[model samples]
Target: MSSPVLKPAAELASTNRTRHPNESADYRRARQALLVEEIELRRQIERVAELRRALPEGGEVTKAYVFEGERGQAAFAELFGDRQTLVVYSYMFGAQREQPCPMCTSFMSTWEAKLPDIEQRVAFAFVARSPIARLIAAKKARGWTRHKIYSDTAGDYTRDYVSAVDADMPGYSVFTKRGGRIRHFWSGEMGMDTADPGQDPRGAPDMDPLWTILDTTPEGRGNDWYPKLGY
Candidate 1:
């Protein structure tokens, strides 16, 4: 089946013309500037993706880590199931924290909605530093029963992927497997940033497409927004 269609903002703008007169020239200019910056940013990101695709594969990982699934006790390989590629999001939910990271929760909410489409290309799993029991409880509380959840309580896998560093480092990493060999494809700590820590003090730019799309709206992602447990 074809991938789900995502309508671009420009297309929508062209088709729908209903601009408010009170919208000042300055406001229009700023909005146009933002749209131009977004287009250039997308081109630059695509270039970076090309470079990443050309790089040599990273090291392998086969350590056995435990996880809690719909069927109870599950292993790392079992989480991967039959898929060739596995994309793991290292969620920042330590064993002591009362709740999972809110930002991470937001991203997972989007992922949960697209689980079926994601499963078509590669398998997806959420790995947290919290214990299996804690992870399961959080999942149940969030009502995320369809997507897979796992625990990296020992910090072995999270450390390997560089997703867990001290208590603040949060990121995403993708890996692929063939036979007994596993190779890292891509690892991005900066979700919407331009550079890493030392390169720029500002710390990478936030270029998440979801945020960009939301920026085009009137409320602009809104102030009091949180992912609900259910739709």
Candidate 2:
């Protein structure tokens, strides 16, 4: 069946804006033009998400990897709990680093509050290279109560999925189970090579909503500013 015709987003965006009493004609025109681009950007975001959802089946997860959790060690498959899908965020807090990556911590703080809603669909967990006890301590220090935290103490999962060289890098991977077999689904692969000029290599749909919210403000994410472990 053919899709129904709809009004162009730009045209729709142009029609409903209310003018402010103190704004000048120039400001009004500029705002209207920006609105058109904003509408187009929204359309592009949806298009990208559609493509992501339609991706083909990924490789089978044949190796039985295990990780350390607060309740002791657990098999990789067990991380999914009762859910069919699992999202693993490989945080950059390895044995070599004294502190966790502040950027990763910042992004995760947002997820803490969103766990209840997110777990209703897919299971989510944060995996790091630190020992299970250390990871738990950091969770407590961060005041996060909802996220499922784990440790790749042996670095097997980290080397296999995040970095073969065991580099201290943040990574995100998703997996799903079907017919009693687990398979890779998707991952945030965007990095320094895919980054735009003068911008940090970041995955689009930017996993962290912090940057997204900041982008909407008058002063966008600055070139030098980055989240620190402590203020």
Instruction: List residue ranges in candidate 1 displaced over 4 A.
Output: 1-36, 68-70, 163-169, 191-210, 217-231
lDDT per residue for candidate 2 within 54-118, as digits (tens), equals 89998999887889999998999999999999999999888888888899999899887789999
Best by lDDT: 2
- How do all models score by TM-score? 0.69, 0.96
Clashes of 2: 0
For candidate 2, the 10 contiguous residues with the lowest summed lDDT are 1-10
Worst 10 residues of 1 by lDDT: 198-207
Best-matching candidate per TM-score: 2
For candidate 2, the C-alpha RMSD (Å) to the true structure equals 1.3
Candidate 1 overall lDDT versus native: 0.69
